[model samples]
Target: MLDSYYLQDLDEEEKAMHEFNKDWKLSGIQRLFYNSLVKQLGGFGSEAGKFIWPTGVTNTLEGDLAIKDTGNQQIQIFSLDGYHKQTFSYGSESTKHLGDVACTQEGLFLVSDGSKGIKVFSKEGEMIHLLKSSKADWKHSYGLSVLKSNRIAVTDWTDGGKIHIVGVDWRMNAILKTNVIDGLQRPEHVAVTEDEDLLVTEGQLFGRNAGCCVKIIDSERALKKTIGPTYGDHYSFMNPSGICVDTSGNFFVADKGKNNVTLFSRDSSLSELVVTQDLEGPSGITVTKNGLLVVTDCYHHCVKMYKYRQEFIY
Candidate 1:
């Protein structure tokens, strides 16, 4: 839910008052009013809905959406109205393929450069830092997650699947790949909850870790639970790739094989399908601060958004 109404949503006079009340969190009544107002003004981005092999996407806390166009090797920014705002590129010999991206609290973005390492860029698209672990052997880093504590988490698909954690100071703290349930193979995508629990989409096409699933790991990197069928079923989860957690702690998993996004409640006791519109091989997914859902459609080479709704707690 929207904790505070964006001043831009209000009239000139009301927007001033909204800014004045920024120090205070809005009340439930105020939130309800703004929620309704926002819904009334809702619309999708991009009239043509165009993209070029977009593989990853993230919802910034500022409500902006960032998409990585793999085919073009460019990062495109879109406003809530679906208008293209900016385009930036960070290409180098080693950082040719920008795998995934995550937005931080201070408008900083962390971009994974496959085996080369990670590159940090400011909100204005300036290159802030390029970090590579000298100790860890990184294969193809795809999934990236920035935790509430400023810690960075990313997955290495090769070397039997591994997750490397970067401390707030931008250094490798630890590597988590062992002690995983059912043998983790290709740990492609990852998401971290407010409580520091890990949600990862892994497993190869045919192997011990076949039939991808989302595994929840505690702060200690121990497996807490798992989602998805052990064998193929309706929920297919053929290649669960991108995963994210909402403010309410609900998880949205983008299954590339299933070509859809599924929602699992905070407690993981209930699950539902929350995406089907133009989900042609949906790969990466994220929920905005106010609960708007966004996902990257790899097959369709486009990005899609929806006004997230829930009959029960998501």
Candidate 2:
């Protein structure tokens, strides 16, 4: 994703070069100013109607943001600049514990609500129905990502771990589970890459070295790459929760236990790029279409936004 802000500085030849090379690279120096904190959204309320323990957030195609306010048991919609839009609760159930939220191409809101499975809602906040899996039962649905071809990928926390890939119509295409063959454990959050691959964050709350890493899985549920304590030198994670990818193939991970966000390059060379400024238990992360980074801080009860710059190297 070439930013027009930076493209204006390049010549015609440079622009053509970038057009030719879709998968370009940026040197470590160019990534020195990769991301910086700029704006903040919801916070602890002095009056009322503010965020409390917001867990997940995702951007809509219209550039608006929908956040899963778990403490309030509702979803809050806001503009990109921190303006409140509207709020809606999922389903008709009395007890609702929202986990994560994702917006489809057609503007439908898919939210994960504990044992209730994924709830589909209309743009006007009308409850559609619960997305039922064709195969595996949703033990504890935690994370969600709208994949290509209108499919949805969600994670189930119980029984070691399980990832179910289903269509918006509730047809399960495939399911990945934890066993001696796969090793997926306590998957928290998920993201779909530009190539349609899945990036899942696996971590545990009360264990060490059991599961604290990010795994890149293909469409067929095959493991591709793992980034964790063994990936790079000095790379470690306590609770790797939320994850998101940019159009440029660069991905970001939010570690709640570490209270920071880490940026991993495309080829996995740069791994220790940590963003810790003004962050307290960063829980969810998402990159905007224009390159702004949005993260939800669970402990502080607010959402932080960052402006990022990208320089491509041919």
Candidate 3:
């Protein structure tokens, strides 16, 4: 028989014993570790009447804002003035985990459900199509970005790692000629450059500390260059998650480990910290048409809006 006990009901000694158990399953141990760490950091439990943890944020063509509430397993839409409009939830309340989201020019919404590949919906929240990745090869879909040609690029974190470029046609199938790009280690998020190059934030999984970095690759899937934790003596990044490029080719990276956003020039010559603090686990980032910056605060359970300072021009 299986025994169930709530960790919150356990005393200090019981909790300590749970942590030191060598024979306990690794998944259970990791859960205990996360719980203990959250408690120690004073960030355990819910946000208490606030918005749930938002993992992805995007602006629709109609200027509405859509946010993925990972904790609540729903997508909340809001007006530009921060007024809640509507929300959509899928699957059982206990099992839904929305990973990332993006909006296309045609008023279509694309969302990744970690295990369920990608789901496309209309602006009114109507289910249009479902694009499933290869279970034999692609395991988990973590991030997604839509290109101007109606092709969607997705980051899969199953085996080794790869990016699946799918054509959003009537059947929502992947193009055979331009399919997968190999050679990535736990790629979480993806950003495209002005010249059509791809940038990916890699190596930030649980238990594996593989020195996170960003990789720039050409259309042919050749690694042109890699920017590791330290570009020079002055700056570095840890567990970088979301990445986006502005009109001028400058890159903005959300470093969740450091809780700051770092701006990098196109030539990789200059890097500086742009926004820091008042952020709890910033995961995804994007620039709107009006030049405002939007970020997802995974732990704080809200999307933050930041305006660029007058002196800092793109």
Best by TM-score: 2
Tell me, what's the RMSD of every candidate? Answer: 10.9, 8.0, 14.1
* Candidate 1 all-Cα RMSD: 10.9
lDDT values, one for every candidate = 0.65, 0.73, 0.66
Local accuracy of candidate 2 as per-residue lDDT tens digits, 1-314: 35577558769864553332222246222433333567788788522347877888999878898888877767788887677888887643223433689998888898887773677788888876776644547767888888877777878766788777765443331233321213578888999987888899987556776688889987667999888845655458887889998777878899887787877777666664446566777887898766677899877898888765443221
lDDT at 234, model 2: 47
lDDT of 3 at 60: 82
The residue-by-residue lDDT of candidate 3 on 89-113, one tens digit each, is 6433323432688887687888886
For model 3, what is the error of residue 20's alpha carbon versus the real structure, in angstroms, after optimal superposition? 50
Two-way lDDT contest, 1 vs 2, winner? 2
Residue 134 in model 1: lDDT: 54
Per-residue error (Å), model 2, residue 141? 0.3
Lowest lDDT block of 10, candidate 3: 33-42
Model 1 regions more than 4 Å off = 1-50, 92-98, 170-183, 207-209, 230-234, 310-314
TM-score of each: 0.75, 0.81, 0.76
- Consecutive 10-residue window with the lowest summed lDDT within model 2: 172-181
lDDT of 1 at 236: 51
